[model samples]
Target chain A: MLKGHQTWVFASKPVIRSASAIGGPFEAKGPIAEDFDTLHSDLMIGQDSWEKAERTLLEEACDKAIEKAGLTKETINFFLSGDLMNQIVSSSFGARTLTIPFLGLFGACSTSMEGLALAALMVDSQSAEYVLAATCSHNASAEKQYRYPTEYGSQKPPTAQWTATASGAAVVSANGEGLRVTSATIGRVVDMGLKDPFNMGGAMAPAALNTIEAHFRDRQLPYDYYDLVVTGDLGRVGHSILSELLPKHQIEIPLDRYQDCGIILYGDNPDVWSGASGCGCSAAVTYGHLLRKMKEGTWKKILVVATGALLSPLSYQQGESIPCIAHAVSIETE
Target chain B: MLKGHQTWVFASKPVIRSASAIGGPFEAKGPIAEDFDTLHSDLMIGQDSWEKAERTLLEEACDKAIEKAGLTKETINFFLSGDLMNQIVSSSFGARTLTIPFLGLFGACSTSMEGLALAALMVDSQSAEYVLAATCSHNASAEKQYRYPTEYGSQKPPTAQWTATASGAAVVSANGEGLRVTSATIGRVVDMGLKDPFNMGGAMAPAALNTIEAHFRDRQLPYDYYDLVVTGDLGRVGHSILSELLPKHQIEIPLDRYQDCGIILYGDNPDVWSGASGCGCSAAVTYGHLLRKMKEGTWKKILVVATGALLSPLSYQQGESIPCIAHAVSIETE
Candidate 1:
């Protein structure tokens, strides 16, 4: 049902039957490495190119997710997946192997929850018995498309956050025993005249705050409704901005419970600059670290707000402000 | 109810309340010029950059859609949109102006029906009172990202198609006075080792056939069920391939009623090469021309299958095969 303004309250909540995460060497050495199912020692992962490596990572994640759910690819009625790559080839190539009816999404970094929301909706509406939601990002692949290639070794700005070379997948279904998606808040694009693509956190912060505000207002829920409120990849900069802006908006949540996947992934590593950010940042963190905490009963309910900076190299070079959006989905273990 | 293996039977039968189409000068002279709501005299639309021109096109289409429906932006619950642009910045930036909750999608040329299917599903599920589906493409923007800058004027193969400088949008509601979406068939990614990005139609033809076959098989319907069966932008090459392959797979439909938007948008112009191809190609054709025909009773029921070539400049440079998918939606007059 439609909630207050922008939220959809899932009447028949969809459950996550199983989920799996995969990461490359850089992410493998990060703080949350133990949470992922598999971590490769190298970026290439035996693949010739970074793009192929990304596809291979996605394939393995999907396969592992299905296996963990005690099912096969045939059981999945549809697969909703996306990535940061141009035209989203990694997810599409991965879909070729899975052979499931596919729907490709592009919300930039917000694709993880975007896919999850759609998959949950399908299961909740009985349109699909089982749906797979997945997303991936490769640092090398992203660098080549968005900026100079890694081989070019251009000087990097400290404001630039590292794109995680990882992938995560989840099997969403009805009557499954795991965390259930109770509600979803789709976001409106918000541009704040921030033109710097290197500082994506600055570009995406307002969008994150906007969605979080809408979620709370539309649901008419106080801050205590969840144990945590985690943002996708706002990194340190955007996290601080959100923290400052929330109270200004008269919305208050415990400071300690407010975490960001970008900040958590690298565990305060200076090499990550502003911190980790990408489609895989939230995906690997949510499906891996968050799920682990939920299974351990450390958290019963939480809100995941995934932010996306919607810009291209052309758009940025053409002097366009970065438009951003953030989708929020509430997950509860019951 | 769940119909077959991959089809979703929309029980609520969402209706298309209103739609709008915008075309640049090139498309304004096309075969279906009369169908579009607005036709600009220039590709730039008086904007400084082609990217901004693309964004302006989307905004106008969306605004016209809502206005034609006798509603405002606030009445729309969600907006699902995409384009050929990398990261879909046009749709995203357009969303900022519309201020509607948005979900960005990517299926290349297949985006129109993919968006329609998602919008219909949302309305049918009662998740939203109204949803808007839209897509756009500019030849200049596409060329700059996919191949060469338009100013470069690189030589192209005859098999290549022209990207339309156009945008199309439709408003979907639970109850409205228009054609209703009865069912949708999501497609599978089918890669046939075709590495040529220039020949997208050839790369996409098999994927289109695969979905059309599944749609027919899943619905247990024959050729006579739909008065017209159209594939998105398979162009001339893909159209011929599909026509030949259908009979081999024991599928037979009237060739006259079977058409491709790629062929229909332009009046067989030699400069268009194979035909018109873009996210806008199928969208403007289906939402504008075909819908007008439906209203005029030229055709009562139809199946629109939108095909997408999922590839990237990086993918092609790295020597990866083109992966493609097609999504089909059935519209009917009751």
Candidate 2:
């Protein structure tokens, strides 16, 4: 019984509806996925409610996860999840359906890892037999909140992570039937006091570098100990910064071997400017690709490092600079 | 040994800053307890980068947590934490100083729990005997992103949670001489599909009610089994609704025995209008008050139930209703 299984990534499947992908107050509607054209026009004026849109998405994902895991709603212990809403509408609204307990979390994009880590603890402590950790991101809403809306046609900086147009979820248990949170290394905040929220990719690079280095050192493992070291939505600028930072420290992790959400979401598409960021970035990547690899034994040991930029508009207005952080955990399947 | 720790709250602490303490943003900007009317006017229009602010807060808090936990920058295994920023600035930026492995999380306000849960997993799995968990919240930033900004002056319904103008943090370790994550119950979302983002107090009421009810049932523990059944930030309206709903379900838990962040922050002051709700609401209560009680042996078993109303202003604008969820985890001081 893997106590709780959850994942975070950019997109489970390629997003077809670009309009629905975007979300946020100024988006004029939920992501184009929620039928933005007809659903509501207030999303344009920043008066729309994203909580409901997230709720519907979360509910669908949860239902699918439970069904795939072959568990009834009653058997599950609680709904532990969260999102970018003021009160975390995604998890909370979805949680209203189950008769079980629920927990809503907010760690930004790193939420999936946090949920998985917690689920691992529950199982390790024998506190519960199973749990769920999940997160999501809507392109339009996120764009409006972070940058300009589609109407604005703002140019994204190379360091800026494209808000992933997706959502990802996972189920962890103690049964050992799936991947296990073999080892989790907590990452502390490391602030060089870098400003520029738009360039979060650059700000978070050092944190990511530090975490990956620490994870390898702490475990007494080499860089190649894992098949891949993944970073969440570092975009082009941050990716290069991390690459250079690692080599400068005499740590040479293969650039190709290490993946990022920012680069992965687009693959070769022109729609996504720099790359994907937000919770969906990590959520979709982990759930859609990494887990599949784990199950197929294509990869044995993997390090999923999800990074987040914890800035708010107010902080920006206060003339405060930007700070970055990252969390790294190793997962392996038997 | 405790791996890491960090803490941060509003620079200004207000005396009447309760759930019902209604006031405009910047109304209590400067040190409220000692100084007032010296509001920081520059924070009016978004200026500085949010990334910088997040980085600063994370660094400050991590320094304190690490100092208190007696962990050095080098020996720390990893950094794990989250926040409300789109990219999880708190953990990412904070990770820079520690120079450790990082994992960012997003569980909304449940992020503190998410961090703790992950820390516990790392420790218990024998992968790491030391780890840390930290979380933070900013009232102005959170409000503007999730709800209307103080400038919006939107009339909040009775059920709306009062966003706390504060932040709190903690460190969880395998060797810390403090309370451990003895037993935790993971939650699964059960959406009642309740709409109405503004009235999350009502939307989330069912989820909280169900989770509390189920926690008792799943563990076969009576309502009286714990010292107090606390909800994060259910304001007056939601608290009343929950109180009524619990009894209606024939689960007569003492209303007085239960606590709400909204109510606790404001004793009798009605200025706030609604009760308290925010990442900081339950955070301060748990880390500041509840932790003290646990240490003093005044309270033994605590079922800390954090509630989140999953609604985004953009979602509401999409003409979508709000959804609510809650997570219940029992904390006992052994």
Candidate 3:
């Protein structure tokens, strides 16, 4: 049912039966490398192009999730996916291989939660017995499309983030023994008139804050109700901004319990500059690390807010500011 | 409830309370010009860039839809939208202006029905009281990104389809006095190994047929159940191909009631080559022309299948075959 303005409280509480995360060479060396289901030693992952490699990652994640769920692809009623590519080709191509009824989404980095929220809704509403939510991103592919080609070795400001080469998939089922998706808060586009694409985290911080505030307000829950709250890819810059902004809004998320996927993904890897930021950064970290942690009894309930900067290369070139959004999914173990 | 593997039977039957179609100069010259709420004499639509113009069209359509629904933007719970631009900037920017909780989608030309289906589902499931589904495309914007730039004035083959410059928006509500959305069939990606980006219609025809067949089979409805069956933008080439393919699959949509938005939009305009094709073509025609006809008692039931060629310019450049998808929504007047 609708809560407050934008939140949906899933009365049926759809379960996430299983999840998988696939990563490339760089992610294989990350702090949470062990959390991934599959980590390729090569970025290309046997594909001829970066885009193809990204698609492969997504396909593998979906297959692994389904297998772990003890289900076949044919049993899944729908596949909702997206990626950080021109026209979201990775998700489309990945869906082509999965051959499940597909719904293509595009929320930039926030696609993971967007897909998951919709998937849970489908299951909760009895529209589907099983639904797959998946998303992927490739560093090289994103760089080539969004900015300078990697071959150019373009210099970047410290505010710039490294796009994670990873993929994540989760299976939401009407009946399952796993973590339940209890609620979700869909985000409104928020633009603070920041035009620097390199500083995406900074651009998206307000959106993350807006969604988080909306989530708590709509759910009518205390800020501390969840053991932890994670922002998808706010990184250090956006994370800091959000931290400063929260208190001003009279929202008090415990510092110890609040974290960001971008900041934690690489764990102080200097090469990443601001932090990891991409569709896959949040997807891989949440589906793999956070969910695993929850299952391991580290936390009972958590809210993941996946953030996205809604700016295309053309938009930036045309002097348009980055419009950002975030989607928050509340997952709980009972 | 799930009717079949891929079809959703909305027990609540969400109503399309109001819809608006906005078109550019070329569409103003089309047969359905009178159906549109607003038509701009300039392709730019008072914007400096084609992308911005496309965003303006979407915004106008959305505003018109909400106003016609006798509601304000604040009363709408969600806005689901997509466009042909890279990362779907048009929808994102439009969402920024509308400031509604947004869900971004990407189905190439099929985005219209994809958004509508999801919007209906949200309302049918009682997740939202009101949801806006909208999409748009611009001839110049699509051409610059997918094919040659408008300034190039490049020669095109007969199989090439003209991209429509238009936008359409529909407000789906839990309770309204209008056409009801009874069912929706989500589509799987289908590839026939066609790699030519110029011939999107040819590539997408199979997908359109695939979804139409699924919709009928899953709903257990007869071929002639609806008063009309309209494909999004198959153009003449893809339309003919689909007509022949339907018989092969034993799916018989009556020829008298069958139509294509692309073929009918321009009404034998030779400059359009094969016909009009874009995200907006089906959207404008369906929301504006077809719905108006239905309200005028031209028909009681109709099925709209929006077809999309999910191929990026980069994908085609990399020699990847175009993947296509189609979504079918059943609209019935009580």
Best candidate (score: DockQ): 3
Tens digit of per-residue lDDT, candidate 3, span A176-225? 69999999999999999999999999999999999999998998898789
Question: In candidate 3, how many Å is residue A168 off?
Answer: 0.5
| Cα lDDT tens digits for candidate 3, B88-154 | 9999999999999999999999999999999999999889999999999999998888887778779
Candidate 1, residues A138-211: lDDT per residue as tens digits? 99888888999677778778889999998999999897689999998999999999998889998898999899
Give each prediction's DockQ, rounded to 2 decimals: 0.68, 0.26, 0.72
- Computed on alpha carbons, the lDDT of every model, listed in order, comes to 0.90, 0.57, 0.94
lDDT of 2 by residue, B1-334 (tens): 0011011111111111011111224324322212111122333223253334334444555665566666664555545666665445445546545655556555555555555545555555444445555665665566656666568687866555556544455555545466545434444444466666556666667767776776676566676887788877677777888888888998878777887766665544566666666655565566656666677897877777777555556556666565554656566665
Q: Tell me each candidate's TM-score.
A: 0.98, 0.71, 0.99
Candidate 1 per-residue lDDT, tens place, B1-334, comes to 3423899889888899999999999998888999999999988998988888988999999999999999889889999999988888888888989999999999999999999999999999888889999999998888877888777778889889999889999999998688899999999999999998878899999998899899888889976788999999988988998899888888888887899999999968989988999999999999899999999999889999999998878778878789999999999886
Q: Is candidate 1 or candidate 3 better by lDDT?
A: 3
Winner by TM-score between candidate 2 and candidate 1: 1
Clashes of 2: 166
Highest lDDT against the true fold, candidate: 3
Candidate 2 or 3, higher lDDT? 3
Using TM-score as the measure, what is the rank order of every candidate, best first? 3, 1, 2
Q: In lDDT terms, how accurate is model 3?
A: 0.94
